[model samples]
Every structure is written in C-alpha cells, then in structure tokens.
Target: MVADVNVFVGQQRFLRLIDEETWATVPAVDPVWVDVPVTDYTVRNRPKRRNGQARTGSYQRRYGANPSGHPSGNLVTPLYGFVNEDLEISLAQLMMEWGFADHEVKFPRSKTAEWQYVGHDNDQRHLGLRVNTATLAGSEAGIVLTLELIGQSSVSFTGAASPPADRNKLVEFLFEDSTFTLGGTPLRVSQFQWSVQRNLDVIYHNSHNPISMPKTQFSETFSITPMKSNKTYDDLRDAFGMPELAGQLVLKGLHNGTGDTGNFTVLTIDFDRLSLIDSDESGGTGAIMNPLTFDVLKPDTADNGSAMTWTEAA
Candidate 1:
C-alpha cells in the first residue's frame, strides 16, 4: 500500500461486546455483533510512560516531545448510552462485574439489577478487550457490540458499525413527569442524579495494560434540587454537623410505550440507609432553592444488608 492518505470523520466511533475468559484479547472467530448506541466516546490506547524523576529535586522537568492526535485531550473510554433496549442483558452484565447478585425478585415483570457474591460468577459476565489505537472505528472492518459496559472485565469492541437509525432514538426522560420521594414522602425537586462508584483497581499480572479492572470497594451518592416547600426544618437539621442515616429515596421513571402496554416501564430505585452528606441551602434565585446531596450504604445483617435496589418494569 503506497502512502495511505485516508481522512476519517469524528462520528466514526462504534462499539460491540463479546464474552471471553482472558483479558485484553478477543476470540479469533468473528461473532454476530449488535451496536451499542454511544452518544459520546473517546479512545486512548497508547502506552503512557512513567516520567523519570531527577536526583534530589534538581529542578528537572524535561521529557520527550509528546504530540497529540485528533480529538486531542484527556484519555477516556467510558462510553455513555441508554442500555434499555435489552434490560436483561444490560443488568446481567452489571451483575457479573459487581459480584453481588442478591437482587430482589418480588416483582415478576420488573427486573432488579444488583451485584452477587455467593457461588461462581456468571460465565458470560466479562468481556476482555485491549486499547491501543487512538481512533474510534477509523474505517476499520469489524462488527458492532451491544453488550452492556463491563467493569470488572473490560468491554470487548470491534470496528466500524454505527447504531441503526431506528435504534438510536434521540430522546431523554422527562423530569417533570417523574416523581421523587424522601422516606416515601413527596419531594418537590428540580433535578436529581445518582451514581454507583465501584472503586475499581486495575490488576496487571505483567501484561502491558491487562483488561483486569476489579471493583474493590463500592459506594453510592445521590443529588437532588429541592425547592423551599420541600426543604423542611428537619431537613436542615439533618444537614448540620453529623448527619443521620435516616432517609430513603423512591424515584420513579416514565413509561413511554403506547399500544399493547402490558405493565409499562417503571424503573424504581430504592436506597434503604441514606445519609445527608451536605445540605446546600445556597439560596438560589426565584423561590429560594436548596439542593440536597446524600450518600448510601447497605446496613448490617440486622437490616438484611441491602442498601440499593433498582427494579425495571416492562
């Protein structure tokens, strides 16, 4: 091939997932792949060098020339997309990575997502992958992956296959129609976002960036915008000094299906033992608002030892 001057576009990033036993490697066979609708993405696989230090702080800060490539900036690989098309596969992937699958099965139609730690981990839980190229897709020949984002084991993705037009519905959940509650009571709020932080630590058994990133510790946090009507006097006291572990968040999702709507999609997230991290009475404009932030943790065996539970209703 003589001097390939091929120019690629920004929207060429695509992804796919495949199951594997090893890390940083995919199967030789080209499996049937599906596309995961990734709205934003990034690729960074170049081996980052550990800067050598000078003896006794000799004012040394010189290094080799580091030139950046296209979409240049920080390194990133956490692709964001709505993994709701196949809730079964999506939550199953998370359960395998989290390693604590004590999910509640009360609701037959609704599926609860959580980690597991009793017997063996699911065989199809992890998908090992490697990152070496600084480009997404980049006109490469490969299939797409729709499997959920694997944390314990890395996400295995092939090349060049954008999400189907029908699959990529550019829609977001309406916040106004949704509901929020504190200990089951109504909470007049504006915005809310919660996240599970799996304190993952990379374990490399001599491989140059092995795909083993384990979630050693886990924690959850929640933040919500509350109006004056919702922020009561007791709520203010909870934010002072030492906060108490006495709150539960019951957040409801929207149902967007039309005909033949059986049960309707209702995503219910429940946090049993929630504590106020900080009270934000910053006094904002218009009705004077104060946002709320709280952290969550599972109680001991006395309370069943479950902090969070998310149910996906179909």
Candidate 2:
C-alpha cells in the first residue's frame, strides 16, 4: 500500500514566545508575538551508547538493552528576517531566553516609557516556546513546549501539553511602519543579519548527570548603498584602530500618528567596542556598496551592557 505525504512551507510557520515561570508547568499568557521568522525548529534527544564485554573478551552492543547511561536533549531553532521597529520587540523577548533583562522605564513627559533590554548572566531561567504552521488546508500542527532539567540527566524535551493560563507573559509589539538609521544617518536598509548564541559550560558530577551553564553573545553584519559624501567608510577606518570610536545603529517605527502624539517603537545598538571583523568596498560596475561585520563587545563593563537597547515609543 502507498502512503500519503505532506510537506510544509517556510512562510506559513509561526513562533509564539511563552514565559514558563517555573519548570514543567504550562504557560498561561497569550503568545508574546506570533509569526516570527523561525527558519527551523528541532528537538533532539540522543544518548550515549555502551558495549558489553563478555568473559570470552568479545564485545557486543545491544540497543536499549544495557541501559547504562544518561541522556541529553536539545531544542534548536534559527530565526532570521528584516529588522524593523515592531520586530525588535519580539526579538528582545527571544534574546531574554538567552539571558537578558527586560527593563521598563517611563519617560518624564510621556505616558508610556521606553523599554531597555540589557545582557544578563546565564541564570537558570526556563522559557517556553510554540512552533506551529498554518496549513494550506486551514489547520494547525506543531509542537508545544514543556521542558525541565532532567535531574542528574542533561536531557531536554518538549513536553506535549497545552499551555496554561499563568505563564509568564511578554509585552506585545506590532509592526506598523518603520525607519532605519545606519551610522547615525537616515537610510533604507537593504541587508541586515544578526545572531545570538549561548556558550554553555557543562558541569559533571561524580555520581549524577552533568549540568550546563550558559553565557550569551551576539553579532551582526549588513550591507548598504553608498550615499554621496557619506563618511561611514572613513569613520569606520578611523574606528578600526580605536575601538572606543565605534558607531551606533538605530531603528524606529511609528503607529497611529497624525502629527506626533502616536505610539513609537525604537531600538538602538551601540558598536562602541565592536571590531571591524569584515568589510567589502566593491568597485564593480554596480552602485558602490559597503558591507561590514562587527564582533560585538561589552562596552566599558564586564556585563557588556551597552550592546543594544529596546526603547518603547512614548
């Protein structure tokens, strides 16, 4: 007999962020943000194997027979997209899982204050995630997350369960319209790429499963057309040797504004300690462009708090 197979599309997928306040509990809040650029979501649980040696000195490996080991699991998802005002808010929540603090501050003259996201130590903060696809047949299918650190076992798994009502909730940010700033100058961006990573240190115990701690870092690279009299190139050259002379990149989004009293979404990234990791100033037949890369550094402190900021529009 033949079987029917179904395939999934890239764009029809959505990622919802849930703040699981505690371990193994269902989240209660509505998804922080839906329809994030989640390229792939994977769950893996692989355990080490052991072989048995008999009296005859012959080795035999039996599958699931010896059961003499602990296992570890991992859930991995890669997200990518164009940077904008609204998306920055969701991105901030995602970064928080990798260990960042969400700081809310109210502007003196405004009703709503801007938000500040700072890098945080890799504490034992557990989070929840949901990945689903809107199918062509108008149905939804995906995995629900409920995971806890396996005691003495370094395993991770997405527990199959409905999210609860008391889950930690992140603020909602929507996309309306946005503007971009490169090197403090206003321009529409053509390319933007950024990534966040956690460096995990595994700790092993004498008679228990190993545990892992994480340290997080991020990097970004982008390309843009050269503007007439643009000093970005020269500025980058000057900053190349002097790390303190790094620049800034800002993005702002506006909503429901007739004059100025509408809502605003803002993001600011400082490159003060960033190194010019890569650069390309092509002299080809096309419009001259500059593509640059930076190694993100913590500015002026061990916490590296000056890397980025997410400010809510007043």
Q: Name the best candidate (by TM-score).
A: 1
lDDT tens per residue, model 2, 188-290: 4344433333322334554333333222223223223333346555576666564323555554434323113435445565555555565556547866666
| Residue-level lDDT for 181 in candidate 2 | 53
Give candidate 1 regions above 4 Å deviation. Answer: 1-6, 19-32, 50-162, 168-170, 230-264, 302-314
Q: What would the TM-scores of all predictions be?
A: 0.57, 0.48
Residue 13 CA error for candidate 2 (Å)? 9.2
Per-model lDDT = 0.39, 0.34
| Alpha carbon lDDT at 132, candidate 2 | 14
> Candidate 2 at residue 172, lDDT?
26
